[model samples]
Target chain A: MLFDFAKSPIVSERQYDVCILGAGAAGIALALRLGRAGKRVALCEGGGLDYEDESQEIYAGHTFGDPYFDLDIARLRYFGGSTNHWGGYCRSFEPVDFNRGYLGDDFRWPITHDDILPYLPEACDIVEISSDYQDRLVDEELGLRQVDFKYSPPVRFGEKFQDEIERSKNIELFLNCNFTDLIGADRRVRSVKFRNYADQELELRASAVVFAMGGIDNSRQLLWMERRHGARFFDRDLPIGRYWMEHPHFTIGEALIKSWDQANLYFALTEKMQKSLGILGCGVVVEEQGDSTTKRLIKDLLCVAPGIGAWAADLAGKKLICSYRFHAAWEQAPNRENRVALSDRAVDRFGVPQSELHWRKARIDRETMLASTQQFNAFMLRENLGRLQLRDWVYQGDEYPDDDVLAGYHHMGGTRMSSTPRYGVVDGNCKVFGAENLYVAGSSLYTTAGYNNPTLAIVQFALRLADHLGKVV
Target chain B: MNRRFFSIAGFLALSLGHVPLFRRYFPQRIKNGWLLKDEDV
Candidate 1:
């Protein structure tokens, strides 16, 4: 049953088996899974059904190191979380992404791709997409190896599953409930402190606490807890807010494709080639230009190459003049320096310290982009597929283009999972080390940010955590 | 020597300028395995 925290009378003490903070994709998925298994869950949402100006202001903080989106605009605080604006491009992480050496460092997923593969169909169903990702139906004659991405009609969890959440006997959703602090004694978390939009203070006691807040908030809360309680609040060597990653994406350049069929081949990567190259996930998209841009391109080409220009000019009124804008989204290796920390100066209206993001692209990230684009350029040229003019930064070695480089809004890795406590905040089971009952259930727990969007994997991991929690609790 | 060379060079240039012929026969002979189409640009 859904309850508004502001409207409800002050309860003496509320108790549950599991209390999940932040009713986003991860939280909602976990709540529903556990609720089905007869565990009482209190799913807390920071905002109500729609967007709120005051709630969003709480996310405002300073960016320290790299150029990044304003903290306020980067995420949403509403019931469905960032899924409210997610582009819904879904693809699973490749097996290579889970490897330790992929990033050439200590970073590695304690869990393998196989561990989450079984739950992907369920995750796809939850996000309302086709479960079958195989591309056998795409004609091979197109010369493109079909890479599958199931677009979610973009499910807003609050609206899509309102009935299920409302009807569930075991789940109680608290709207306008912002998680303030974790109340813990020894090694296990006992309860959580929260406040409503109206600043009504409340506390909830639960056997297990799952922080399903989005990447930024997940780390922010943990950092805040560690600061308030002590250094070893969660664990003795808790790497609570480190190893942050983002899928850095930009338009690398333009490719002149005489035919759409020829250009499509360069757009997607085959599994065989991806494995052979040991690439940590990259996708190419060929976006067609509009009429005005097409005319300009043809006019520009006519000055030098009259043969192709004449051909292009003939089709000005007949068809779309095929100038494909080449876009690439590549994985950012987890960098410890690129992290989330509590701002020493800033605090929200509730007097809670705001989060400070320190983000920068590593040298390896630039090298990988260069290598991948060069490899693609070579392949296209060899096959006589098309002529590709690479962006300036790609040809200019060693330095990443700082001017217009944008992240894919995919925040990952902070409470990264590891078997050994020295490297990560959480264990393979998503439980914070030393804190037996506390678990994290979002992209923040990701050890690596694969090029694919995080929503599908977030749901998959949440479901995995639910199954684990169901068996134990 | 100059006249003879010029005549031969002009003939070769004209023959190579035949894009249709190059599209039809050159790909099979070159064997570089590029998908050469016999269509307009």
Candidate 2:
């Protein structure tokens, strides 16, 4: 019984207390949080529910630390956004990622890990992940049992919270609606415009606007608006699409022995390791480099008791059910050069300019990978746990052995959050500088957290924004 | 006769009634057309 805008082209777009664009993890979570507080919320999204776009295309790609598999970025463009395609890997950002002055590129967020610490559990509820309000299990916080468990049930938001979304009286979701721009009056956003495949445009008037699109579309929409309206961010050398970052993932080598019995690890042990292990799209572990830090988080490598995969087919009685876990995510540094920008040329359907994303890794990024690989190999050897192997394709050219062969799925840091407007476009609360009521919620707000999946942190941030809006509204 | 006129990708080709635009040099329109291959399927 949700407000289904499945067939209709034009949906209603009137003024509301809050307007959240992109019904992905951030948008939907915030809508539910604010709606529960009795605030009228308008949740606008370009794609319809459940990865259900007929115009989608599929292809092959790599995820976490695995070989290239058949994947599709285009298959995602709907109400749920990319959350449908997510492998349920969930992890929180490490302390080192929240920088005072980011190592290379922009600045750190206006807020800190402690700022959003109180809202983690509420965020977890929205994601359907069993979590405490403050998931601070690691970092010698209280020294009382840190992050002993991990949760990511391969959950898809479409079916997971469809009922909850439908039942909320405060939230009104308009699916099949694509947000085009934020019409501004003075310093605040006056309204938001969107359309369905039928080519009908609808605009919503609001007091504040929160952008919740996925990494790619989020920047695409901002860049499109900037080009069309000539916003303040365009001229200031602010790193909008620049400093694009992601955790490079792929299995380097495998470890198998002559006497290998069944004894593989399902989820990593510590919360730091859990967050950084790159599983459930949650928690990341922090490792200190010679001068910096590193983490390895790749999702979707099933680790059975040990000889599990080897005997998965042979075991007749017990269906060799090998539980999958994301391997690792090497910490990635910021490079001003690796970015996505509006190609002076390309334009999309609604006369908005298309994004020409030029994503590439830097030398420091490769160095970190090599360092982690060597450290990991040594760790496995010292423990005499299991045979360790690195995928051949990943060890070739420093970091990106084969640029065409590797993966860049965990897109991060574009309209990066920083303390100063000169450093990044948005502040810690994700509000854009010089503009009030315009906030961005996504991985794009990260300064540099080294290969950590951003969904968990963003959920916390979305809920936190709701708390702030509650007091003000 | 116009190899330079177009290129095709997987995402756009599957949509029924939608035709993809692979402009060799310049894009002609933003309204991408769908494919007419349900008959072939």
Candidate 3:
């Protein structure tokens, strides 16, 4: 069975068992998983691969989280979604993280950490990281002694899995298509509308629709369509585009650790610690920030050894951009106020309502910064090998409601999954709370920022959703 | 002159030591830097 989806928009009356939207990490990951299970799938994505689109801009948009920090955040109008630009940070979300115990909100996730834990290997495949990083926190609920770190040969999935996706008989990847809105009957979402960039093709429909657009676009698209199309259709009874969260992380400090032979910060780890921490995939450095959480670069500390930097300098600016951004992928906590909602939105070139993110910090968010500073200091004290220094003019925040420069790469929790439709948009299994055959695939479903990053968790959840949907949807 | 004053003070202290003279006070906040405000959740 050959599936031919070229530049032509797939808006015909064909019935696919699964219609996945936004071919970024979440969308492509789920599509791949479902296709592997012999399920017929149609995947749609906005934007094109890499930074190829002439219009793609990182710093032009409003700051929901600092857009500048996420240099690789690109939406492919093509296949294999944003993984084309994503850094391969393959760390798992811990168990207690699933609960809303810390947030004090009525929200609780429908799924547990254990439910999606088994899909780590598949998640590794989706991220194109090593399968054997022992210390990379495998099923931490089962007794997390230390993290297992590994490095991806660091290839993005768009290039890595392009052949496989194209070759997959069960998967039909529809590129250059945008998910306009959803079409549902009764209480179930039956299909979603896909329009072409040139408007050559009309609205295409499928049986099941998944909004796999990245966090910002997903929130904007859902809320935009909801406002224009009416509230009764797309899970509108709940906070449709409210209570958004992003991990407010900053580059508080950097250090040169002499523990490894390379004696640099970012990527020189001995085979022993990598082995001790379960080496082979994710990169980790537990260093101190003294008393600041400035920019969101994974876990207060990261490293890029001298040799790699030397090789990178020769690659020139644009040539080595993807690799350089891939090196710097890391984040910390998700503060609720550091989110996006409807503002004085101006429509983008696509005529879709783009958000003016009121990405401000409240007094409560300051506690995390203070805590980050404290924690960094403690970690530096404990791990005595590295000498920590401020990146200079790095500690941006003064206090709570203090205007601190912060941003989050992991656009988490807008159409969050919960047991209750009132508190969330989807169920634990990634299903729309009230509607059948409607789903979401992105970091937006995360109830909290578990500090370990969302790609791993999103992939795991996507795989689980496929399994669950296979049985029921 | 300082010795004479010390001697007098020592005598006064000796006299005062026999009698209930002073009490102590404690500061708010604990040693670990945690402060307690209201008890309500």
Index of the highest-TM-score prediction: 1
lDDT, ranked from best to worst: 1, 2, 3
Q: How do these models rank on DockQ, best leading? A: 1, 3, 2
True contacts kept of 1: 0.02
- In the range A3-45, model 1's lDDT, one tens digit per residue, is 8886874563767999999888999999999999999999999
Residue A6, model 1, lDDT: 66
Q: How big is the positional error of residue A276 in model 2, measured in Å on the Cα after superposition?
A: 18
Q: Which has the higher DockQ value, candidate number 1 or candidate number 3?
A: 1
* Candidate 2 structure quality by residue, lDDT tens digits, B1-41: 35433334444455654432222111221111211112211
lDDT of each: 0.76, 0.56, 0.54
Interface RMSD of 1: 13.0
Off by over 4 Å in 1: A12-14, A100-102, A135-145, A231-233, A261-279, A298-321, A397-405, B1-41
Best by DockQ: 1
